[model samples]
Target: MEREHFSRQFDAELNDIREKLLEMGGKVELMIANALLALVERNTELAVQTIAFDHEINRLEMEIDEKCLEVLARRQPAARDLRFITLALKIVTDLERIGDQCANIAKRVKELNLEPALKPYIDLPRMAQAASTMVKEALDAFVRGDENLAIKVCQDDQVVDDLNEQIQRELLTFMMSDPSAITRAMRINYISKCLERIADHATNVAEMVIFMVKGKDIRHTIA
Candidate 1:
């Protein structure tokens, strides 16, 4: 009876940690969306709010790390359970970094808003959307233990990369044409790079999920 009770408690603790990770993922996704919205709409208030949201993401990351450590010390989980806990620790770090990228993008947006409008902002928003979708799907795959969905997330990263490259090219053209537009163009370039980095982090999370599900280390393997 005591053994069964201990098993039940351990499972419950793992489940609670998983839920917290998902909650953190959701908040990060919103931060990305709002950051892009602020840039496209020139909404400084929304940009400020998005920057403020990073505090919660940072806090949750610390809390999740503590829970994972407690589980490792007390439960001494093995096999897949052990893998899950370690993956959770890694995922939270990626999520926290994604939050940082969002904050960076928000800060750039505020700067851009003070200046006159750049171009139509066509590619940056698309890149942000793709990166955010990858994050949401990757987290969903982790929760559902869906290896295929996670693989899809890895595949989707190239789209964001391509968009980022296109934005850089377009912005470079703008800077070449008008010296006065150089500062604004560079800021937009930085925002594009931030979104691309967010996608890269999401890819990292998806790779970890694939490892957790298949017991295979497919980090650098071709899709």
Candidate 2:
């Protein structure tokens, strides 16, 4: 009876950690979406709010890390339980970094808003949407233990990459034609790169999810 009670308590602790991680994931997703909206709509207030929200993400990361340590020390989980805790630690890092990228994009958006409008933002928003979807799907895969959904997240990264490349080419052409347009072009280029990096981090989480589910390390595997 004592052992069963301890087991139940351990499971509750794990569930709490999972809930906190999901909360962090959802905030990061909102940051990504708001950063793009601020850029496209020239809403400086939203951009500032997005930047401020990063502090909360950072706090949640620390809290989650502490919880994982507590579980390790108390539960001494093995096998699948051990894998899940370790993966949670890594996933929180990626999510925090994703928050950083969103903050970077928000900062750039504020700078871009000060200058004249660049060309109509066409591909950048699409890239942001694709990257955001990957994040949401990756977290869902983690919660559901759905390896197939995680694999799909890994495959979807190409869509963001292609859009980023196309945006860079278009921005370069504008800079080449109008020497004065270089400043705005460069800012847009940096924002595009941030969005691409966010997608890469999301892919990292998806790869880790695959490892947790399948016990196979698939990072950098050609697929």
* Candidate 2 global TM-score: 0.98
Question: lDDT by residue for model 2 over 126-197, one digit each (tens)?
Answer: 999999999999989997889999999999999999999999999999999999999999999999999999
Task: Give the runs in model 2 whose Cα sits over 4 Å from its true position.
Answer: none
- Model 1 C-alpha lDDT per residue in residues 1-223, reported as the tens digit of each score: 9999999999999999989999999899999999999998999999999999999999999999999999999999999999999999999999999999999999999999999997788888888889999999999998888999999999999999999999888888999999999999999999999999999999999999999999989888855
Which regions of candidate 1 are displaced past 4 Å? none
RMSD of 2: 0.9
Q: Check candidate 2 and list the clashing pairs.
A: none
For every model shown, the clashing-pair count is 0, 0
